[model samples]
Target: MVPTSSSTTDRVETFRLGPFVVPRIWTGLWQLSSNAWGSASVSKIRRGMARHVESGYTAFDMGTINFPSFDHQLIPRTAADHYGSAEIIFGQFKRSLPSPEQIVGATKWCVFKRTIPSRAVVLAAVQERMERMGTTTVDLLQFHWQDYSDQNYLSALRTLKDLKAEGLISAIGLCNFDAIRTDEICTSLGQGVIVSNQVQFSIIDTRPLHGMADVCEKHGVKLLTYGTLAGGFLADKWLDEPEPDLYSGNLTPSQRKYLDMILKAWGNWSLFQSLLHTLRAIGDRHSGLSIANIATRWVLDHPFVGAVIVGARLGVSEHPDDNQKAFGFTLSDRDNEEIEAVLSQSNGRTIITSIGDCGAEYR
Candidate 1:
């Protein structure tokens, strides 16, 4: 059964991530890696980090240094250098904290190209991540292998397991891996080796329900989900609003990306508006919670979901207080039925097949 509590300290909820216990809502720093999402100075970003930690949102998800381009977009190596500063900033912020041990830093090492998965190669990758994060041991290192045709990802994982034995990594996880690959890796590596898989799971994008959920349950792995808010489109401000123009200067890169998924892949604007209305009504039933809280609660309600990685734009914008509301309340059966009623009208299930799986859009 899913855990719930009435205590104020237990409001946010906590889950076991390997040997560490982390809050279910992690502060995602993906926005700090790109100016397209808006930028903030280092001092300002650190201050924002302080505010989140004080609010009991101490877990952070950062990107790798000089990592390959994400979202299936190819970026020049020189430009890619600008992408992973979130790790550095997070590392600095952690060091500044008197209780740095309370902070959980989860970063990624995405391999977009095929390479031999020798121990040397894998160690180099881990070392680079360690150097960038300014920590000797990574709290959680999530690996992303772009090509599935190559089976060497298994070997790379074995190397990561060896590194874990050497005290370089506390835990190992996967990012954007589909159900089959996740199952195979966990099976090949044996149980207790893989802790989590990060993917896009939201009310509109319910692809995980198809098969990934079962795989996670079987392997004793949990999901660290992103895009649960659909780039803030699943919030109150978007209700009763007209469709946005992709080319308009108003939308951030993530907003543009999710907007396309909503219109072209998930459903049209009208259907999304219907979903917003349903969520709004449900939120009202639960003491006037925000639409984003209802949406996030839907994802966290799943027993297999370990946490939801909500993006924070640091000093530029943050909603730590509001995000905390996602916890403390569980959705009623009526609330779920109301959500499913609108979902049945959309093309989410079909999108699952068309898109292939959780991370198929990127592949």
Candidate 2:
């Protein structure tokens, strides 16, 4: 049940997830998975989580695979220190404080094995996630599948749905599933079992708008978009810059991944600069926001999109104040036309035709 009325604060937008409403902007902690991004002090990560909470971006997206280190595996440990408990932390951002239905702690289990996991194996994984996050139940448990041929993805979701029925998981969602498979899941499970599909969607990557958007709209499903900033390449920092070498020491793993997507799907650096310049101009029209803010807002305006996942560099960087500018002003039809004009001329079309669907890149 997605919200129909205006949100309590313009800084955040709300959408329904099972019995709860979640913020439209989610804090992505995938960067914590590796040290490719510069390391930050624990204090910085803790303060950053607090700032994100205070700023009303409470819906969090984390994954077990994202944090490979065993010692400090879960970053939400910082939230525990700041807000005392997961309930309190998530409750503080919701309109109704301490309400059981406000917070959404979404985590995922990536099934990489050639064989499908059984019900018992899946349950153990979900329980482990709950224990790691310091919560009785996960607000949403997103599952990622690498092989579509393995009918086990369906079995996994069914197990998750059962967990939801048993009060272990509040909702179930998918990550990186394509339109055809998403349709299959919905048909197999019947309605209302799955709430969202987390995929890569951005001004550069409009693959969701092609097929996934229609499928989601037909059903009641919504999309939680990541790589929306192309791993921070969509920011103004890369505008008019030289094409970075693939092996550049300065590039983080995330940056390298998205940069390749940019080159392959978005064409060369000059074209990207043009797109960035257009976004910056649009931002200027509305209190000089930022290329990143304008880019994020563009995705949020898409009808089937529930939220945009922006990666937070824990303690190293903070952009709450700047990110809030997305809601300060709306993109006029003219602004949209201008942005589309640039996209129409780029390699976006070729990328769409070549790339099968939202998750084709991974497959």
* Candidate that would win on TM-score: 1
Poorly placed runs, candidate 1 (over 4 Å): 1-10, 63-83
What's model 2's TM-score? Answer: 0.86
Give the Å shift of residue 340 in candidate 2.
1.3
Q: For candidate 1, which ten residues in a row score worst on lDDT?
A: 63-72
Clash count in backbone of candidate 1:
0
Report clash pairs, candidate 2.
33-66
What's the C-alpha lDDT at position 249 in model 2? Answer: 80
lDDT per residue as tens, model 2, 1-363: 123223424557678866767888888766555556766865566567767766777677773232211122222222111112322333233323344344466777666656457888888888777666667777887877877877888888888888889999888889889999999999899898889999888998888877798889877898999888887898989878888986688887677777776776677788888999999899888778889999999998887999888887777866876776776456799999999999998878666577667665555
TM-score of each: 0.93, 0.86
C-alpha lDDT of all candidate models, in order:
0.86, 0.74
Top candidate when judged by lDDT against the true structure? 1
lDDT score for candidate 2 against the true structure: 0.74
lDDT of 1 by residue, 1-363 (tens): 112233444567899999899999999998887788889898999888887877778799984222222233443322232335888888888887777888899988887777898999899988887888789998999998878999999999999999999999999999989999999999999999999999989998898998999999999999999989988999999999999996688888778778878887888999999999999999999999999999999999999999999999999999988998998778999999999899999998887876679877666
